[model samples]
Target: MSQVVDDSRGGAGPFSRFEFLVAGRYLRARRKDAFISVIAALTLTGIAIGVATLIVVMSVMNGFRDELLSKILGLNGHFSAYPLEERLTDYKETVGAIEGVPGVRFAVPFVEGQALASGLTESTGVSARGIEFASVQKLDLLYKSAVMGSWDGWDEGNGVAIGSRLANRLGVSAGDIVTLVNPNGTLTPFGRTPQIRSYPVSVVFNLGMVEFDSFYLYMSMQAAQDYFKAYDDVLVEGAEPPDVLATDEEIDAAYQRVYRANAIEIFIDDPDDIATMRTRIQSQVTRPMTMTDWQQRNETFFSALQVERVVMFTILSMIILVAAFNIISSLVMLVKDKGRDIAVLRTMGATRGSIMRIFSMTGTAIGVAGTLIGLGLGLLIAANAETLRAFISNTLGVTLFPPEVFFLSTLPSKVNAGEVGLVVALSLSLSFLATLYPAWRAAQYEPVEALRYE
Candidate 1:
């Protein structure tokens, strides 16, 4: 039996350990065939490129998802409650009750409708949202997000907020009066009719998203109620009719009478909590079909992102798998070339297990080194993807992702540590697994036969 020495702690004679010598020699020895070194370098580079590309792509996807979610949640409420029927009375008391719910950040009553805005030169379809001017300011960042004019202007008679693109389409500016026509108009005894109203542009907002910027508008609740002819419908049973324009005392008494049945809308600040609240609210509200959260409203877009992330990760992982094959071939060649040395070592009291460990260690070294290098490269690229993209754009004289083609103008990356760790672990595991056959072959060599060939 060969006596194994514990040279790992410097307590043994010469050639006392198996793995350290084999790995060090294999890495440092000058090879007669430079192709081996070249192949190894290529394998390392391939792994680095693959890992870096995967990190950059995943990070960008995550960034896009985050940006889109922010835009949606910022502009829209976390959750919205409306009447299951067509109308809600006593909206003020409902708002107060919803505001008391835990995690509720703000609650407001809103009315919205679709209308067409027309100027002298052009006309466009737009969605008009009606909100209390003071409540709207507190509930949303709309005031801060506005590029021009004031949200308060909507309080002034017949004032409206238009999107930047809508403004451009209609060829109008703030303070310019545009005619709004409701195509879904009430039927008159005389003929089919359209309700036409003129509103002066109060504010113009640009959210940096073309979809919203082209379609959204804001006006006061009073204006929207009048426009939609819904004021009478939203008032209490004994309240003065909308056409009468109730005084403050009458409005307060009317609100108290109908507050119990009014449907309330709640907005929360945290998006992750939205799902839980949505489910709870859906179950809690008597009219379950009427409430909705922003996530439910934008499920399609969010689902697409999840699908994209999985597909991209699966596809990029193939690059590392291909590189693993190179490692297998390189180790196989090494095992064949060292057959004679392996036999001599066996004769000199080296166990089959030791020989196995030697080759296994060599392969492990290659994999570990490659994995570390790849991780560094990937993280570096993730940290500087924007700068690299900008530099490339400047050098190539072409934008890699133009805002017209891509929603975002610049490359965005966010490296998740867990994601990076998983990638490195996967790459290293593949490389180690690929070395198994070659290492096993080295351990199975017949000593006498291998020496005879030498």
Candidate 2:
């Protein structure tokens, strides 16, 4: 005890060096309270597992959200502007105006409408989108990801392209003819009847999304506008029939078509600065236009993913919280078991603060050790997430990540520094708090009472 007092007085630091030495010894040495050691080990394991799971889960969530965003943004423009009028006739000038905005990258006129697609075997409803092949190819995603046929021949005015899922449903392929029924047919003295026309399938595209794959159809700029009567020059619903009772095909063919745009598809430099860019774009334009940004377009989807990420983080953090409780239990037993030593140290000149620091250091050491180990393991696992997923799935002969279910071929992970810091900070804070009661209880021991009991 004189040696401890000498060591305490010998050090000029915040606490005696002797305390840290003893704390480490206590942590490593065999204790009569074997169950206490087991509780301590369990506590350490819990903290490690909690931190690891939180990092891995959050990373995967971030990756999944990012992948979805990439696919959506790649297929759809970052921002789209709809005209106040039914169709934007002077879309060439409008595209120039939108492109003049600083952040605006790619601005192109697009025509969108609905048509009933009829194949030889079956029929289905489809969203028809018209794109400028040359300008849109500069966007390049559609051109590059085309599953069958080149991004050519669409400009020939009579060609059409459908998604793979749609192709499968309709039992049609490229070069085959698929009839599109336009409900807004020539309104004659008789009620408006359906106008159907057959067009050769130009290509098949796979957007890697089930909804898009099954329902979207694409065509050339002139072809789509002409088919849907998007332009005013195209025949109005009901003017006159060529014959008193014209067949549907004859009625459909009797139309003069011109280019009319329903919307301008725009790509911006920074998606995060959509509002500033939107304001800038609106300022540049003279017409009353409505702009929908990427976030606004898919608000519900991203919101749901964000909510799920937060909920998962909260639930997984409880693993560490439970470990904190175990830390409290282990420390309490240590304090009780070390009561005689605490009293002897007090008589030998160790202060109450010194006793508290020693026990607190013990608990912190465990927490820090567990946290570091978990952090390392978590990052490693997250980095090689796809690899790990494949290995487990192959070994177990189970589908760990189904492409149809998750919308991805393999698992994804994105380890964020801020999230990792948050987990580490939370773990350390919990560990520190768990040490308080036991450390204080140990520090409060009276030398006389403790010695008498001993």
Candidate 3:
């Protein structure tokens, strides 16, 4: 009895060696208490699954948001300036002034309109953008995305660039001809007549975004202006026709005199500094123009994505909460099954706090182990997310993340350390809290009554 008491006490301390020893014994349960062990295993598995799921889901959501933002903002500038009252006839000077502003990267002038494009296979509606060759070269995203053909003589020839998807849909490639029909065409005595024209596909670009790749086409600034007849009224009123035998410089000067841009698209160094950048640009341009930022244009779409992410996090968190409840139930059953052991330890000079500490250790060990395992599993899965996605997609003969619906061509994952830490903290906190009730119940066990039944 003296040795048993000495062993159980293991010196006068809060969490003595004896407490950990007994907790370990209870964790490695005997055959009679195998059912309790099973519950504990299930509880651990539950916590592990919950943490892993949360990490994977959060990473995917982050990746989705980042990819979409990059693709969208990469194609569209940070903001654009549209004329309020008059045609942007002097857009070149305006662009120069705007580009001189601090934090401004570059400004481009382009004409955008809708047209029906007819290919060999079928006809589809296209968003046509007429941009200068120099400006097109400055658009890093579009310029670098060219997969077929070259932009060598982009402005010299009557050719247009189309997205890779659009080219594929039209069953046309670079060097193939695609016809465009404009509903708002030249004005005639009868009425405004639709204009039909054809141009060879100069370049095929893959923006890696479904919407842009499937619908957008680009032509030269001169071609766009001529096709759209932009600023025709202003030109007809302001400038006279050049002489037939005019010099090259004289003719070029006359062209510039009449040329006008629909809007000036401004790219800034930092897109997040929209308010300050807008103020600076507006002040520098001194033109009566309405400014619009990327954030303003994409507010609704991004807002919906943010809301969906929050809701998904909340829903997935319930899995962890349910696992926490399982921990409580499993510990309660373990404490009940170990009633005789608790009584024996109490009679052998064990304090209530010692008994509580032992059980708390038992439950918390499960939590810590589960959390660590989940952290490893989640990181591994996230790191090889794309590879796994492809493997699974091939095996199942189904697309996991279709580019048409998701806007990205492949599965993407970005694991944020802060978010992973939060998940770990939440899991550990829930696990610790769950142990309190069962530990308290064990601490309250009356040695006399418990032993009398035994």
lDDT of 3 by residue, 95-210 (tens): 88988999999999999899999999999999999998899888888999999989998788889999999999999999999999998988799998998999999999998889
Model 1: per-residue lDDT, tens digit, 1-454?
Answer: 2443233223254333555776678766465746766777777777777777777788888777777777677767777787765456657755765666667787777777899889767988888878887766775556676787777656666788887877888988888888999966677897768989998888888776666777888888788877766555245656655346768776666653312223345778577787777665555444334677777888897898899899999999999888888888888888887888888878766667667777777776777787788788877887888899899999999888776555654566788878888888898888888888888999999899998856
lDDT of 2 by residue, 1-454 (tens): 7787777656767767898887887798485878777888888888999999999999999998887887777778899899885468889899998888888887878888888999978999999888877665766666766787666656765787788888999999888999988898878899888878898888888776666778888888887777777766466466564686888767667765456788888988898998788889999999888988889888998999989988999999999999998898999999889889888889999888888989999998889888988899899999999999999999999999787778765587898999999999999999999999999999999999999956
Total backbone clashes of model 1?
0
Task: Sort every candidate by TM-score, greatest first.
Answer: 3, 2, 1
Clashing residue pairs in candidate 2 are 187-237, 187-238
| Model 1 misplacement above 4 A | 1-18, 29-31, 119-121, 139-141, 152-154, 171-178, 185-189, 233-265, 269-289, 386-411
Candidate 2 runs further than 4 Å off: 9-16, 29-31, 118-122, 157-159, 167-179, 186-193, 198-201, 234-257, 390-410
Clashes of each: 0, 2, 0
Best by lDDT: 3
- Candidate 1, 239: how far from true, in Å? 11
Q: Residue 29 error for model 3, in Å? A: 3.8
Model 2 scores a TM of: 0.85
lDDT of each: 0.74, 0.84, 0.89
Angstrom error at residue 97, model 1? 1.1
Candidate 1 least-lDDT 10 residues: 256-265
lDDT, residue 354, model 2: 83
